[model samples]
Structures are given as structure tokens and as C-alpha cells.
Target: MPTGLVALLDDVAAIAKVAAASLDDIGVAAARAGTKSAGVVIDDAAVTPQYVTGFHPSRELPMIWKIAKGSFKNKLIFLLPAAVLLGQFAPFLIPIILILGGLFLCYEAAEKVLEWLHVDETTKHDEPAIVEGHGREEEMVSGAIRTDLILSAEIMAIALSEITDEVWWQQGIILAVIGIVITVGVYGAVALIVKMDDVGLHLATENEGVVAAFGRGLVAFMPKLLTTLSIVGTLAMAWVGGGLLVHNIAAVGWHGPEHLIEIISHPLLGLFPESAEMTVGGIAFALLSGILGVLVGAGIAPLVHRFFPHGAEANE
Candidate 1:
């Protein structure tokens, strides 16, 4: 080969190797960040299906798609650059933002709890009211996306924290990868969950034997499952919110709440076998955090209703 051609091929190979290494780095960072954010991811998944609860079956996937697209816009378009900038220039602000987001989650959870208890007459009822019209659908999708923005902020923050040492461009690439992967994973699961009854119905009608039986079972089970998910989602909001508050509070120099949670949850570890102690302890801590969330939320709820009475009334 000509010397010039050989040099060109060597340069091309070196560039390919560099690109491959960058991809590998991103993959590893994304995985670590995603794993760290799994709890929030699960909460996001759990919280989403509730938005589509009263919509028609045909609208379920479409609504989820809308929300998913909005989620992408949140994490990628808006949050990705913001995270990069903040991570580089304003690291101190991140925890404060998380704390505020936690409060919002707590407030939302508390409002739902108050509504469930009949103490709040301004909020929507527990029974899924068939909300009609494009306007209502848009409202619901927007709300879901707004909630997603908070959760995605946390996810991106977590991911960004993991990759803070990387170059700015690399951090952005990894964060983008994490954002896309998580949005797809979360909404894909939501789509399946929301449309499960439709799949069940199809199988129940078109198949027979065990397949039909299972389909019938699914058809019957989805409503209860959705209800369970609603309840779980609410609790998840509380726990995630509370967890954020406690941890971030500690991050900001107030270790009192964090210590309190440890004090409350530490004893529970003894209730389980040694092998299960970590799992039990973690659950205990989460439940404790959730209790704190409930308390904080309850405190804020009355104030919110008093100040934003029209906001509640609008929902009604």
C-alpha cells in the first residue's frame, strides 16, 4: 500500500477505536446511573398508569405515547442541557431543586390522601371518572409530563452525579443515553400495563382452553391491578418524595431527619434473617421516610388548599 493510504487507514482505525471506547464508557456510566435511579424509575412507572386510568382503551397507548414524548422532551431537550450546565457551574443548586421537587411530590401525595379521606372536597374523587374531550386529555398528559419532569430531573441528576468527572460533552451524551433508555423502559412498561386488559379481551374472545382462561383472568385482574397500582403509586410518591427530602436535607447539613429515619428503621433489621436484613432495613427506612412525607404533605396540604382554592376547585 502507498504510504499516504496506509497513514489514512491508521488514522481511521484510531478514530474508530476512540469512538468505541467512548461508547463503552457511556454504556458503563449509563448503567450505573440507571441502577442508582431505579427506585425513582419504578415510582415513575407506577405513577404513570394512573393518568390513563379513566381513558378509553383505544386512547391508552396514544396517551402514553404523548406522555412519553413529553417525557423525552423533558429529559432530553430541557433537562439534559440544564443538567450539564448545572453540574458544571451550579452543583450546589441541584440538591435544593431536589428538595423542592420532593415537597411537590409530598404535596401531591397528601392531596390525594386528603381527597381519599373525604377531608378535601375540592379534589377529584377516587372513582375513575371517564374524562372526555381533547382538552381534558391534554390536561392529563400535561400533568403527567409535569410530574415526569420532576422525576426525570432526579434521574438525570443522579446520572449526572455519577458522570460528573467526565468531559462535559461526554456527560451530555451519557445523560442523553440514560434519558432515552429510561423513558422507553418506563413508558413501554406503562403501555403494556394499560393495554393489558385489551390484550386479555382479545385472547378471551379469540382463543380457548388455558389461553382463554388466562385471558379471562387478566381481564378480571386488570381493574384490581390498576387500583392496586394507584395506591402503590401514591405511596411511592410519598416514599420517593420523603426519601429525597431526608437525603437532601442531610446533604445540605441538617442530618437530624436522616438520623431520625435511621433510628426508626435500624431496629427492624433484627426482625429478619441475616441474609434478609439489608432488604428489610431498606424497606423500613423507606417506610419511615414515607411517614415523614405524609406528615410534611399533610402540613402543606391545608395551606395549599387555602391559598389555591381555585386550583382545587378547577380539578373538581
Candidate 2:
């Protein structure tokens, strides 16, 4: 009986070790997946601060928290299950769906550009009665969540594609980890960004020495920073969208864009020294891809506006 009990304990220990190892694997996979989704992650972080622009300082963190929760729900509740189901049953559909999502990103970026250029003919009418306080906050939160849903979906999909040959449960666990980590990271950074000027102001008023100067500098830099973030966000959307389309097209069969990028990138290889060739090539390729994304988005914007005439001029 004692020997049997010892054997049982040994079995338990083995199982425990296996479970711990699996947890470790999940952590590693989650981190790797999050890293793979860097572009979308960066875009998500960049785009989010815009929603807090008009809000009172007190409202910023709460709104961000709400959006972060929504982003978590988007990934863990909606996209994760759907992705698993799709991976299990309809793996073939992944690329098509991703391509469609990419096109939507492109369209959004293009619309913004057209609006900025004053070339878009869509007109906007102000809301009937302006919402106040809680209602306005709700609207902003909802809009931010809606945008986050798309970005989260793309992030989850990108993460999903990075995973290979894992069992469904493992994939799910990894995805959950990634979703939580990314949501926290992106929104946490955004919360910091939106409150930076406040922090600066506090420091400037309450502190002394170089800290005050630094605080004043931060205050001076914030508007430009916001503007830069907006531009970067738009460009990131286009670059990511274009990359997805190009890579997926190559995955299916056509390699035209891929080949073109490589060809365009090739000249940079010679211009830079050997060590920087890859970096230069990558930059060249990204630039070309971003341009392609912009062109594709611009081309499709008119069609989208024509078909969806109702809210064409709506600010994204």
C-alpha cells in the first residue's frame, strides 16, 4: 500500500510538472504572439488617445478603462472563440476575412485623408441635442470601443496566425494571455499619454529645478505629440493594411506585390553598407507597402461612399 501511494504521489508530481510546463509554454506563446502583433498593437495605442481629446481630464482614465475592458471583451469573448472555431472548421476563410479587414482599415485611413484634403464631398449635420456629461462619455466610450473592436480583431487574428500546430485549448489559453497583456499594455500607455500634460502641469506647478523645465517642455510638446500620433496612426493603418493584403495574396498564389516590394527594396541594399542592407530594404519595402495601401484605400473610398451614402462624411 505504501509503494502504491508513493507511485500515486509520483504520478501527481509528474502531472504537476507537466501542467507547469504547459503554463510556461502558454506564456511563451502569448508573448511571442503579442510581439508578432506589434504593428497593430502600435496602431491601437496610437489611435486610442484621440477619443479622449475633448473630454475633461478626470474623464480620460475612466474612458480609457472602459475602452480597455471593451477591447478585452472584443478579444477574449468575441474574436477568440470565433477565431478558434474558424481555425478548427474553416481555416481556409482566415485569409479572406483578414484581407477584408485590411481593406476596411485602408478605407478608414483613406477617408480621413480625403477629409483632410477637403476632397471628400460628404457633409455632416450636427446632432439634434448635444449629449452632456454621462451621455457624452457613453458616446465616446462606445465609439472608442467600436473602433477598438476592429483593431482588436486584427490584433487577435495576427496573433492567431503566428501560432502553429498547437491544440485548440493551448491556442485559446495563449490567446487569452495575449489579449489581456496587450489590452493592459496599450490602454495603460494611452492613459499615460493622455494624462502627460496633466502630469507636466502638476510637476511644473508643484516642483522646482530642471523637473519644472522638463514639465514645461512636456506641456509644450503635447499638442505636437498628439498631432504626430494622429498622423502616425493613419500611416500605421495603411501600412498594416497593405502588408496584410500583400502577404495574404502571396500566401494564396499571387506574388506581384511581394516581388515588387523586393525589387524596389533591392536598390537600397547596394546604397547602404552590408550591415544596414536588411534595415534599408525593410524600410523601402514598408514605404512601398504603405504607398500601395494608401492608393488602394483611396481607390476604394469613393466606392464605399457611393454605396454607403448615409454616413460617408462621418469622422472616424
- Worst 10-residue lDDT window for candidate 2 reads 123-132
* Model 2 C-alpha lDDT per residue in residues 7-100, reported as the tens digit of each score: 9999999999999999988888888878767767777888788677777788889889899989988988999999888777877777777788
TM-score of each: 0.81, 0.85
lDDT scores for all predictions? 0.84, 0.82
What root-mean-square deviation over C-alphas does model 2 reach?
A: 3.4
Q: 111-183, model 1: which lDDT tens digit per residue?
A: 7777789887667647788778899899989988887887898788767767878889988988988999999
Candidate 2 residue 292 C-alpha distance from true site, Å: 1.5
